[model samples]
Target: MQTANNCNFRSSALGPAPLPYHPHHPGLPLALPAPVAAAPALPVPVPVAPVAPLAALPTPPPPPPPPATIVQTLTRHVPVPVLVPKPFPVPVEKLVHVDRPVPVEVPVPRPYPVAYPVEKFIKVDRPYPVHVAVPVPRPYPVPVAIRAHYEPLHHHHHRHHYLHHHHDW
Candidate 1:
């Protein structure tokens, strides 16, 4: 069999090219041809017309108040009374008494001994006297030059000292 690219001839030359002939087995074929039957003839139906148009209706008046019954229209009106609660009473307590036997039992305690101690006298000796040495004064020696220098200064200031001492005026 020839591949697609190898077949260069135009298709119109062979009425649709005979469907590329495929190879079949000598003993068995892949698929057998199926048989077909023609369709049955159907009956033609007659056409139907639409229903007639509805009549124009008159607007109905509101229905009369359901014809009032005698028991409902003549009923009476009554107001119920309010109930007031009552106050509760105060409670009182009760007393009870009981009796029993009494017993008298006294306890006796043991006596403890008292203790007395003996005394002894002790003597202390006095300390002996001690002798301490005292320091004696020594006479200081005077320098003649010092006494002479101070004599002149003392005499020069005698008049100032006397004037300060006398303030009678």
Candidate 2:
């Protein structure tokens, strides 16, 4: 008799009882002797074609006479209005030009031979020139819409939520 961790292996009838089934143990099917490599599959013999059956089809029938057709007439009527002739009512008034004279106002010229102040552009020299800044552009996403100010008239009533424990008293 041999002993292993509370299990007994006796040198008698039942040979070791095959250990308790572990996948890593040497008692699996792969540990048995392999089949003879299957004899190289024998090449699978070539198949023969199928033969025709012994039955045949039936024959066709004779000609049918020309079918008789009855005539039918469907009519729909609609009324159209006819127009009448009349004279046109246009009033014609003949107009002609009337001739008369009225007095007119014209400005007298300032007889000097020089350009007016409004027509002259002059550049004056100074130490400090007034700076008008050109704003530097920044890369930002352009807004597509400008929303109007709006407020809802009636507000919904909502209760304040509280977590319940019952022992929080």
Candidate 3:
């Protein structure tokens, strides 16, 4: 029987066991082999050459100058003027006086009347009678009973007999 951890199927002499079908990729192989380690890389070879001493060369002579040729020459002149501003005079102000009217004392009357109406009141007498019936509670009866002849108490005797019988057991 196959367990959860070891779910890989084994092949028999009859034929190879059918691979489990996947819902997505139906063409995938069932059993894959363990991965192999990569091969070791070989070292690359580098070439070394011998160094030689350098020799200094002689400097070349300066080049000869070409023949000279002359072109036309031009000259121009312009004039600019300098200006100076003159000073302005300061203005002077004069004051004038005018007379206004004087106020007089006058009395004014009130807008509404000063007097109001007097309030009147009436008095009532004779009272009405009201009667309420209050409930009075009655006293409860007291229990009283007289026995002609009292029977002998048996509960204490029964308890004593039970205790003695249990001690003998």
Please report the candidate that would top lDDT against the real structure. 2
Q: Count clashing residue pairs per candidate.
A: 0, 0, 0
* Candidate achieving higher lDDT, 1 or 2: 2
TM-scores across all candidates?
0.15, 0.13, 0.12
The sequence of per-residue lDDT tens digits that candidate 3 reaches over residues 41-156 is 88788787955545445557788766323211112111111111222011111101112111111111121111211111101111111111111113211221111111222212
Q: What is the lDDT of residue 14 in candidate 1?
A: 52
Q: What is the alpha-carbon lDDT for the whole of candidate 2?
A: 0.25
Q: In TM-score terms, which candidate is top?
A: 1
Off by over 4 Å in 2: 1-33, 50-169
lDDT of 1: 0.23
- Give the residue spans of candidate 1 off by over 4 A: 1-34, 44-75, 87-169
Poorest 10 consecutive residues of model 2 by lDDT?
100-109
Which tens-of-lDDT digit does each residue in 67-155 have in candidate 2? 43421211221111112112211111111111211111111112211222322211112111111111112331122111112222333
TM-score of 2: 0.13
lDDT of 2 at 126: 18
Candidate 1, residue 18: Cα displacement in angstroms equals 25
The full ranking of all candidates by lDDT, starting with the best, is 2, 3, 1
